[model samples]
Target chain A: MEISELKITIVGLGLIGGSFSMALRELKPKKLWAVDINQDVLKMAETQGIIDRGFLKPNIPLKNSDVVIISLYPEQTVNFIKNNLNNFKRGAVITDTTGIKDKILTEINNFIRDDLEFIGGHPMAGKEAMGFEFASAEIFKGANYILTPTDKNKEENIKLIEKIVMGIGCKNLIKISPKKHDEIIAYTSQMPHILALALVNSNHIDGLGLFVGDSFRAITRVANINARLWAELLIKNKDNILGQIKSFEDSLINIKKSVMEMDSDGLRRIFEKGSDMRDILWRL
Target chain B: MEISELKITIVGLGLIGGSFSMALRELKPKKLWAVDINQDVLKMAETQGIIDRGFLKPNIPLKNSDVVIISLYPEQTVNFIKNNLNNFKRGAVITDTTGIKDKILTEINNFIRDDLEFIGGHPMAGKEAMGFEFASAEIFKGANYILTPTDKNKEENIKLIEKIVMGIGCKNLIKISPKKHDEIIAYTSQMPHILALALVNSNHIDGLGLFVGDSFRAITRVANINARLWAELLIKNKDNILGQIKSFEDSLINIKKSVMEMDSDGLRRIFEKGSDMRDILWRL
Candidate 1:
């Protein structure tokens, strides 16, 4: 089906969901509906003309949506899918914006109907803010969108999701396995969040504000995170995150030992390696 | 003496020295001189009118200036001061842009002439890039300027340095002891640099570039660092930095354990603490 002719519904009107609706509005879908527990948020999105309609419950929208994008916390997403299994239209293409995918996909696979298509997706873009009020379409601009397709997904449905991703100004569309996605995300996303949080919680002298440099500010930008949401993501991907953390601890210990022994050459070599790696990653 | 009536010479025309020259240009001192071993950098500064004159050696400029700002590696700054003990004019106010302070100040104190005042100063500002070519007066704009003054420094000399710091567009002037500066700096500056480098060097899945996000990018921005300079800074402030590293490891291990145990409430509480700390730090 053509994008403009398809009816779409976004579940949960938070930062990611609201942003999805705003970006999808530009595509001019036949109908753009939002399902959120907060009635005030529904009123706000509709008043702003970001969606054709807003539903406090998922049943009505789920029954009519040709495509449903569930943007909720990890566990909430799984439960939402389970509770609404009987409500979705036949052959409807469904996707989710969950951070961890392997377990989520496995759980859905056990109960999902044969006629429906469920694609796992993660858009690697967000602000440290929360809720529908702070959402903006610009967050997805030039973002990397990862789509994890299993055998249950049809080629045409994946193509349709790609069209929507591109319509929202995503620059890269990475297709990978669910397990691969979780492992890579543990390193790139979850580990960094943990480091930032730990750095902020570390002990420091009084009046730390007076001595902070650009490096401190940059490293701690994401320290003001969404605790509830991140707790769910981090715990759900525990093993992979633990592996990444151990690797990070090894690197940190090596550098710390060089400093303790006053090993200038060793410290210099490690720093040089870090610089070269960052340069290569950025250039790619 | 008034800032406009003072003759100022800046040693080492690297990023900090070049930027010092540019920001001081706005003050219009009696004479702005730069000293560097690299004759090409000296010629370029002179040609660009950022300095009234440039010297390949410090002998001539050091003998005449009322104020001298040494912007060099921590060890190099100490050696230059020790070697040029007799060259500085009587009662000249000298300062440095070194990252570490306690050791540098102590070494200079052993041989510094009582007739000449050497007040320790560190402009808490820099970019990942190095060298005179990347310097800009704007780097100091609204940045924090730290002054570590001992009994050897006269009240008027400290005030004079404050005037220059303000003239260079610094927003805050921090006055503390050299020992305190090093301790605080270990947390705010050196430790963050180590973490960034360690994070970049950590193991990750191949094709990691496709999964990069803002959190990773912000956390690793300082990974592309100045190896020689950072190694010197990290080792010179080794004891304090090691203390900070231990503190950070404790925090990280606590958070990691919560994830391993699947303690959702424990994870949320820790994240809340981090978020609160960050918000409070930034607000202050």
Candidate 2:
């Protein structure tokens, strides 16, 4: 499918959705549509030229589309897919930019009409800032683009969606088992937010944190209240994120045990292990 | 005092020393002497042109000079200061570019000669690569240059050292007690490396990481290890680093508890507290 000929519907005109729309526009999709719960945001998205059209709700006419891209939070993504499945054109490929995927995959498998297949996507990109104003097309450049397709997705559907991501300037094409994808992301993506949340709150004694230095500023850069979004998602993907958090917690406890006993050798091992790992990551 | 009139001696001639020398040269210091135990590294430093003159071994004439700087690992920093103390000229201002200071400060306070005090210098600048070849005067530009001067340092001595850091490109001059500096850095600087280390190692499991995607790479980039150097310091400051590790551990356990019980309210409270702290940090 040629970039200019493809029609795109971006559900949820928040940061990810708005930004994805901007990236899609660069590929010059035929018609860019925006959907959001907030009518004011949809209007703003249209005025800002983020999309060619805006919808206050998803159930409105969306038939003029080749692909339906869902960018809602983890908890809302599946239900949003269900609500709008009837509106999509026949054989249209549905995908999402949601952080958690296993749950969403299961929902699509169980709830969506058999005719409409939902391929999963998570362009591993974002920034500290939130909302539509901070959205930009270049955010996807040099970033990983994932395509998760179930048994139901036609081979053509997966390739068409993959072309969209490639045309939008992503660096690599990654196709992984849906379960495997969610497990790794839970560790790298969801858990960091959880840990950042923990780091900020742990030191927040009596609200005297105003004097925090650049260290705290750098570490907890993402801890700000996207509370409704992050909180709901954390609950939805609790098992995997909790496991990642536990592994990190165990590492911390081990280091603490070594330090308290003044066991230099033991502590050194941990640092060595940590450093070796960091070094490997740089190469990758 | 103008930079052209100042005499400077930089010991160890590695990344920190070489970079300091290069930057100070631009500020027009009168004469610079570089010393290192490694003859090859000393030759490399001279060829890199970070110093005007160089030494492979310690010499009395250099020790008797008015100013001496030691830029070595934390373990070697105190010994270097103590070794040069008796042979130095009277009233010579000594300083070091060691990462940690509390223990070094206490050791110097009790052991060093009264008239010649060692003021600590910690320029918060770094890179993944090491050695004089990787050193650039530009690294220190705009970084926070901390001067930890104990009561042992005379007012005149403190002013002179501060002038040198300011002469180089450091923009922020922060004065902090050695204990506080150690405690804060334990959390900010030291702990981040540890976290990066653990994160990288955890991701390296099963060689299955071959398919590891972008978010994993982004989060674990800092894990790359300089094992010999980092292990040495992590051991020396085990107690403080442990305290920080424990605090983070407690946070993870608490979040895990909230998740296990499916307590949405508990999760929100935790997320909100972290968000508030993170938001404020981002503002700055």
Candidate 3:
């Protein structure tokens, strides 16, 4: 299916949804629809010419949409998919932009319409800002887009999704199992947030300005996080996130032991290993 | 007391020394001297007009230098001062640029140079790249320069050091006790390095390229660190760094328990505290 010929409906107007809308706008889809519970956001997006149509509530036109992309908090995304499963087109594709995938995917796949295809996706790009006002299409350029598709998913539907991802300027499309995606992202994404929050909580945070440097700023940049959204993410992916936090704490303990014992060899080994990992990332 | 009239000698032409030289060059000192064991570096700096004179060894002219800045590694800086205490001119303002200060200051202050004054400084700025080639004066522009001065130091000498700091483009000159400096820096600087290293060491790091995101990159950016330099720093500040690492691990454990027990309220509290800290920092 050609990207330009498809009818697309975005079911949120937050940062991810709004940015995705702007990125997809360049393709000039057959009919681009923007849906949000807030009438002001719908009107703003329409005034900005970000979409060809705006809907305050899911209605008949959405049922005939070729693709429906739900961009909401993890739990809200699952609820939206569950509540609107019957309204989706018979052969249309439905996808999501949620960070935690395992629980959301399992719940949505359990009772989703057999006539419709539901694929899980995560555009691994974001800024510290939120809302449609801060959205930019440039965030997706050359960013990694992880797709979690079960074996039951049709190859044509996966290919169509990949085509759309490429059209939106995401050059890296990685296909992995839902469980594998959750496990790796637990380490790469959620562990860093946990560490940042912990570091922030460790200090008298108010007086940190006088003593901080670039290293401190870089490590804690994500500390100014969306608390409600992250709380939902933590609860949904509790098992995997808990495992990562455990491993990370163990690593921190080992480093602390080395420092306390003045074990230069142990400390050096940890640094070398860490540097090796960072070197690989730097090369990439 | 004037910066332009001071005859300055800079030892160890590494990144810190080279950048200090570049920043001081704009002041057009009376006679700028560069000292390094690597004659090639000395020659390069001389050819580039970064220094008026270059020396392969710390000779009598260094002893006569009115102001001598030692930009060597922490251990090397202490050793050099200990070995050449008698050779320094009486009342010469001697200083060092080392990250970990308590041990360095103690050893230097224990020496027999009654007339010479030794002050410890840490310029809170650096780049991953090293050597004189990558040096830039802009690294010190508006950078925080922490000075650790004991009670024995004269007020006039402290003012002189501040003048040099200003001459080098460092607008932030913070006067702090050595112990207080170490305690705060252990949290602000060393803790971040420990966290980044531990995060990098948590996974099969070599295979992390495909699954990583911006948060991972930002958190582990310092993971591409100088192993030997950091090993020395961690060991020297072990007691303080160990305390910080313990507190950080405890914070991580708390967040982990919240996630494992599905305590959303507890998790939200942690996030709110962290965001509060980040907000304070952001305001700075």
Q: List lDDT for all candidates, in order.
A: 0.91, 0.74, 0.86
For every model in order, the TM-score on chain A comes to 0.97, 0.89, 0.95
Q: Which runs of model 2 end up more than 4 angstroms from their true locations?
A: A1-8, A23-33, A44-53, A57-66, A84-92, A204-218, B1-6, B27-30, B44-52, B204-219, B282-284
**What TM-score does structure 2 among the candidates reach?**
0.88
TM-score, structure 3 vs. true: 0.95
Candidate 1, residue B268: Cα displacement in angstroms equals 0.4
DockQ of each: 0.80, 0.41, 0.69
By TM-score, how accurate is candidate 1? 0.96
Residues A111-223 of candidate 2: C-alpha lDDT, one tens digit per residue? 77767778988787777577877888888888787777878888988888889888878888888877777777676667656766776665523322222444445445556
Candidate 2 per-residue lDDT, tens place, B142-251, comes to 88888888877889888988888877888778888787777777766676566656665555234334345543454455566466677666666767776777787787
lDDT of each residue in B1-284, candidate 3, tens digit only: 78888889999899999999988899988889988999999999999999988887687657778889999988999888887777777789888888888987887788847888998899988899778988999999988998998987899998998998977888789988898888888988888888998887877433555776788889999888778888889899988887787788778888888888888888898898899977876677
Q: Give the CAPRI class of candidate 2.
A: acceptable
Residue B250 miss distance in model 3 (angstroms): 1.6
Candidate 3's C-alpha runs over 4 A off are A205-207, B205-207
Q: Sort the candidates on DockQ, descending order.
A: 1, 3, 2
Q: Which stretches of candidate 1 lie over 4 Å from their true place?
A: none
A99-144 per-residue lDDT for model 3 (tens digits):
8888888888898878888899999888888899989999899999
Report the error of model 1 at residue A184, Å: 1.4
